[model samples]
Target: MELDEAFRFIGSKGPLKVGWYHILLYALLVFYNCWIIGFQLMGMIFIGHVPKNYQCTPPDGFFTNDTTPVLDETTELDKCHMYEVQDGIVTQNITECLYGWDYERIIGETSIVTDFNLVCGDAIYAKIAQSVFMVGVLAGSVTSGQISDFFGRKIVLHIALVLKAVSGVIMALLWDYNALVASWFFVGVFNQAIQISSYVMMTEMFPPEIRTISTPLVSLIWGLAVSSVVPIALLFPNWRHYQIFISVICLIGVPLWWLTPESARWLISRGQIEEAEEILKKMAKFNGIKIPNSFLSDDKEIPLNEDIIEPSNKGHDGENEGEVHQQYYLLRAVTK
Candidate 1:
């Protein structure tokens, strides 16, 4: 008999819904998504790009919000122009941030902009680096979906988590700009890969009746992470520290991926009958429900349960239009 037949037989004998074992597994899965959301949002923290507020560099003292070094008090503090007292008259010396920028630390410490001097002429690179990470997200989503379909959701998730963790940590520690950009791409790819795999497992683990309801539950966790990411990121001093913090946080889910059982349906579909049966048995034992030994012990012929499949009829035209009437007749006959 097929696994669905077995599940139906078990369902008739004992309840499969609201089991403690399943609930615990689902709870872990939800927690995993929440952290994944937080980690993804942390990627948006650009510490080098500090808040823009500046004044002309003073001849002696530093340029500040309240005060600036100037030759004359009459010349207004120019933001984009260099103030030069030419012939006792203030004149614009068309220039950019020549003396470098003084950043505001109100939101957080230095961003990638300040760390790499990503302004004046090098600012576009920062934007490109972020765009590359976004591209990785797209690539990872497609690659992970195909791999999970071929391999299995559990194995795919394990690969993704490991890859993401390693890449994220390396991204934090790297000093080279080019290498960090590449690392960011890999991190996006693996992070999103695991997210997709985890979501697929979440939907498949539950019964069809409850699967729809579980959608919003995962989204609720995701929503909570979205709301909390900004505040949590602020706790860190700079973008480097924030990156390190989120990378460390992502490691917490590594063991979770290992502990969680492989999807039973996926195992059965892949012809790993014994492995599928083992998970089912574990769940049954944990839930204090009994599964018949006959259904699991032997490969010998077992009688198929009749309740799972109802007879269907086709019209003379080879269509299923007559199915309702045929089912009605069968029901009436059974009632008699």
Candidate 2:
């Protein structure tokens, strides 16, 4: 069988046949990918809550009811602070008080760096780490295309998951920033590829009528990911622990992997008709739906009669012979 045909058959095979199983498989993959968005939200939690606590200063005019002070230097530090709206919350942090400056002009960037002892080297190293991770993502994105096209999505996804799992362990164990960056880079590359390949596989397998909805529904996984990242981060606390959390999640994808059907389109395109037909039959049986008499008869035949007139298109007129021909061509193009 030709490569293109094989891919088409793989994608088109028995997508609707298994019904609930098919739904669940797609749901898990989509949800997993979307969950990455949650990781991004962790920055919000870090920025908002990672500061030290401080006592608030009282608003003016809280001294005693007396118009004038009872004693010249009797101004007790007012502990009864009243709430006052401010541009930003004035919170205590870890910065040591400067000799000349009262608050070290804490509103500005200089104060932040001075308070944190953050030098140019700190920023530089952070940038370098980020760049390494991004490079890994870019590399993985490129490699995934080749991997998915050549090896099939299921195998590629497994490979990506393994990389992700390893990266997580490496991140947890390594104390060196450079090593962490390197591991993260590989993780990014492989994880991203798996994500893309999974999405592509889902898009290919679903019926054309449901393609639009399925695509977005699958994308909802990203939204789910985003929503979950903060909670995941909170659960893990440390950044290294967060990596472990992500790794665990990736591991969960493994067993579900078996639930997925090989793409029927890909199978048909590859000329694995028997396998494709079997998958289709199983799908119908699992879904508790009956195959039409003609379809059943077609299945029973030893070798598919290439000349047999396929049944009429249902629910949609575009499924006429001409459109079916177009679909066949498109399927061929994808396999190639």
Candidate 3:
């Protein structure tokens, strides 16, 4: 029998019989993926934060009183330029900061701006780093779905999770600006891959009714996770430490390689009927339902409205079934 027919058969049993398996699956796929992606997507807000107050440092022995450079009425000692002071005389001549900048620790103790001295003339690199990461996200969104289809959802998800974690850690430890930018790009790529693969796997696992609700539920969880970044960022003020903290969270998903099953729909699509049956059997067992012996048999043409092994609501009538099918197709198209 086709996998869609099998899902319809099981779904007719009602939520009580299927809720257990979906609860476990949702925990592994939706909650975890959304949480990690939330932090990674919004991480730049803190990581690339520029201090509110910054000014060019003066040369040693140039200032005897307050180190603030004396500026004319029109000019001020901003991050990029400082006034030249000689023997306590303020000069009108303004010069680009030859010395580095000193930042007030208003936002956090340190960020990419302070760590790399990204203020003054080099400030644009901060935006460039974020833009590079976004480009990786764009690239991943275009490619990850096809990659997941060619490979399998489980393998792609696990691979992306591990690589995303590694790249984030690498980004944290990177000293050079170029290296940090490159690492962040890959982090964005793997992060998007994780999002796509997990989302697809999640929608495939649920029946049509639950699947309709699941999309919004995942979005709500993701919004909550995104909102959580502020408190978590406050806890880890240093950018490197904040990054490492989120990277380590990604590692928590590694064990799901063994804990969760591969997409049965994907397996059926690949003609691995036996493997798909095994996962379905596991789901039935967890959900306290049974699959008929002939459901997966090759000799028999499985009936669409066959009586479920366990008693529940009657199967949908032909007319209701058609409507359900229409709604399912509509949901599928909307999701795609």
Candidate 4:
């Protein structure tokens, strides 16, 4: 019997049914892909927020608000420029802020913008940080697939998770703007790797019939995770605390390394048939199904006749039959 046929048989019989194992695995994958990925992608919205109310710092004796006139000719207060003031007379000459900027705590207590003083002249660096992170994502997306294909999904996922968490924490603690940007870049890289590895591993383990539903379900989880950023940001207004909070969340998946199983199909493709059979047996036992001794034997030749095989509970129309055959051939191609 083809590996795909065995999977279908196991799925129909009960081993691959939507049970506790499936639920646990799906939950882990959702947390890894949706929650972690969403936070990493959307975190910049809060971290890089530029406060609207800020102006150049006044001299020790001068007190000025955002609307305070810097130049005698105009009533506008420049955020990046300051004018010398003596008594009640303001100097006509305007110069870039020499001391620093004073900001109103209207948006939040702290952000990368406020912490780094990324205003006016340095505001572009905020966008640069975000852009650098995206470039990391693109690089990770390009490379992680090949790495996972070689090293197996579970290990790569865990490694990426660990690295991502470390990078996030480092990003929060970094004092230098360039160092923070560099750390955020790695966070983006490993975040994408975790998403890709976990997602592919999850899909490979699930039955093809369940995949259609699972895909949209994963998306819904992702949307929810993304939407949650606002409330989370509100709760942890400080950028450092927020970064640490989300970074620590990645560690939740570390214990899952023991609970989750490697993809049986991946094992089979790598010629580890004994390991694959063991996992299958465990799956069957969990679902209260007993497999025949010949189910995975090399000498056993199972017929492909549709009449002999039981139809799926979802009903196997011509289209479904075609899909099954296509999957079987695809598996064979991969194995070869």
Q: How many backbone clashes does candidate 2 have?
A: 36
What are the clash counts of all predictions, listed in order?
10, 36, 0, 0
TM-scores vs. true structure, each candidate:
0.74, 0.60, 0.82, 0.83
- List the candidates ranked by TM-score, beginning with the highest: 4, 3, 1, 2
| Candidate 4, poorest ten consecutive residues by summed lDDT | 326-335
Superposition TM-score, candidate 1 onto the true structure: 0.74
| Residue 156 Cα positional deviation in candidate 3, in Å, after optimal superposition | 0.2
Task: For residue 307, give model 2's deviation from the true position in Å.
Answer: 30
lDDT of 1 by residue, 1-336 (tens): 455444433343233444676678777766656676456645465543545654444333433432333335666554443554445444455454446555556765766766666654677888887888888888988899899988998888877777777887788788788998899899789878877888888887765656777777787777777777777666876787777777666676666765689887788677677787788777767765555453443543333234433456776888887554333222111100
Q: What is the C-alpha RMSD of each candidate to the true structure, in Å?
A: 8.1, 11.5, 5.9, 5.5
User: Which lDDT values do the candidates have, in the order given?
Assistant: 0.65, 0.51, 0.76, 0.76
Worst 10 residues of 1 by lDDT: 327-336
Q: Which parts of model 2 are misplaced by more than 4 Å?
A: 1-18, 36-119, 292-336
Preferred candidate (TM-score higher): 2 or 4: 4
The per-residue C-alpha lDDT of model 4 at residue 66 equals 25
lDDT digits (tens) for residues 1-336 of candidate 3: 556556655555556434467677877787656888888889889899988877777777664223455455744545577777667665756777767777888555688989889876688999999999999999889999999999999999888988998999999999999999999999999999999999999888876666788777888888888999999899998989999999888887776678788998888778777787888777766665566553454433333233334333434563443444322221121110
For residues 76-185, write the lDDT of model 4, one tens digit per residue.
Answer: 56678877665656675667777788888854568889898999988999899989999999989999989988888888898898888899999999999999999988
Question: Per-residue alpha-carbon lDDT of model 2 for 159-239, expressed as tens digits?
Answer: 677777777677667766567667767767876777777777777656565576778765555665666665665665555
